[model samples]
Target: LGYANKTQLESLVRYDLSPVLTNPGLIPLLEKEAAKQKKRVKITLKCETGTHRQGLLLEEIPEYTTLLKKTSFLTLEGLSTHFANIEDTSDHSYARKQITLFKEFLHRFEKAGLPPQRNHIACSAATILFPDTHYQMVRTGISSYGYWSSKETYLSFRAHTSKELNLEPVLTWKTRIGQIKDVGPDAYIGYGCTYRTNQPTRLAILPVGYYDGFDRKLSNSGHVLIHGKRAPVRGRVCMNMIIVDITHIPGCRLNDEVILLGRSGDERLTADDMASLAGTINYEVLSRINPLIPRRIVP
Candidate 1:
């Protein structure tokens, strides 16, 4: 369930019992020991639901539901499923079908006379879109991280609710300028020399580049903030650096803080802006950040 695996759950259950079992054949040994002691062992199963990324198929779900019914486990605490797409309002037919199927399975479960204590089917998007689907608890992801599934959903929720929730962004980025140089009119900049100086230009080079998850496709199209003002990215974003025209901003220097993705003073470079330049989404922009870079959390 909810992106969990057998190995992980098994570890949690086996931790206490693992050490005391003398026989290497532990399952039999533990059962025999339990029989001697007149105690029983409990087992839990995690079933998959129909999620976009990972889950059982809708067609295959009934079989899983049937399996759950037949199995006589010591503890059967819950049944669950996930919605495929909750952000898309233009078409919710898929999500609606999934919800319907889950409801059908729950009805079957009840007919089997083995209703569970928990029956949940609502993630961040579904929870917002269909609160009635929340039988017990909602499993959230992106929304917990201060972003809605999409702009349409967020706007709709805000319009109806008439109140803003206190959600803060949890990530920031900054890098030092790698180098700085000046070029006269007609001078070419970067690979393919795609950009020629319209006028004499002073440029600052930043060490962050495509390899570091800055999109190479951005090229001359992206924007960066320098000296508290916006500067156009020049030429191609190289393997480990990008050049920006800083002639307009006075007092540009080496080792000045280069904000690849974050705010500086009143200027801000959002993940959405990065996505726009890269022809991607905000999720991709933030997740692509290389793990090798140090991350520090500030209150």
Candidate 2:
């Protein structure tokens, strides 16, 4: 609702894109736009279960519902809430309480005699961890990219259930080796001269760096796959380039495929691997990839 300007509100009315109502203040604006377009706008109320992010409180439901009742073109399509802690830990006590509160919110809507069609609360973690959270529909993400919500979520699932979800990575961040050069023994590589060769080394300069979300911390620590071989990153990661020691991978030339995060034969560089090196999470590594980078959908 924060980004819902006049143009966006009109777009909602013009298109059948169901939107979530986080704040009741935006209700009138949406209603006004819907009235102008003579369109039935589907709205899902995001209730404050426990996350305390963007959601309406229980006490505030009455006025919001009443206001919705006044808006003839506005239809309450769903009642949803986000889990506060479902993936980070093996414990789901807080998430259970959130589910309870969400149920109360659903009952509140039902008592008001305006039951929503789509009663959903499950995010990627919630959908994976708790089955009961799956009401009318499920919103599965990360898993769609063939990755687990988290290691904790995976452990919790394995501890409680026997089902094994065979999740193979579907994403592959690829770049071409922009340039390759040979460095004599003890020669420095890249900025700050962080890496010096012990012997003659062949380097593959990749067109990516921290600016490309190839984290700066990966300098001299991370490895990329080239010619199905592990090539160690050399020196400090630059704004738009990183030098990798590719001497071991023979017969590699300029524009050869470089795997920033993916597999090459038996070698794989995953977002999880990168995160471990960067002292962050896989989600951050995946999400921080520069949006301007062109993505190719492999069939």
Model 1 — TM-score against the truth?
0.74
| RMSD for each of the candidates | 6.4, 1.6
Error of 1 at 252 (Å): 2.1
The sequence of per-residue lDDT tens digits that candidate 2 reaches over residues 1-299 is 33354557888889877788786888898999888888888988888889888888989988888999888889999988777778889988988898889889988888988887798888787787788989999888788877888899889888988887778889999999999999899998888877889999999999999999999999999999998999999999999999999888899988899998889989998888998999998889989999999988878
The residue-level lDDT of candidate 2 at 25 comes to 80
Off by over 4 Å in 2: 1-7
* Clashes per candidate, residues 3 or more apart or on different chains: 0, 0
Best by lDDT: 2
Query: For every model shown, what is its TM-score relative to the native structure?
Result: 0.74, 0.95
Top-TM-score structure, candidate number: 2
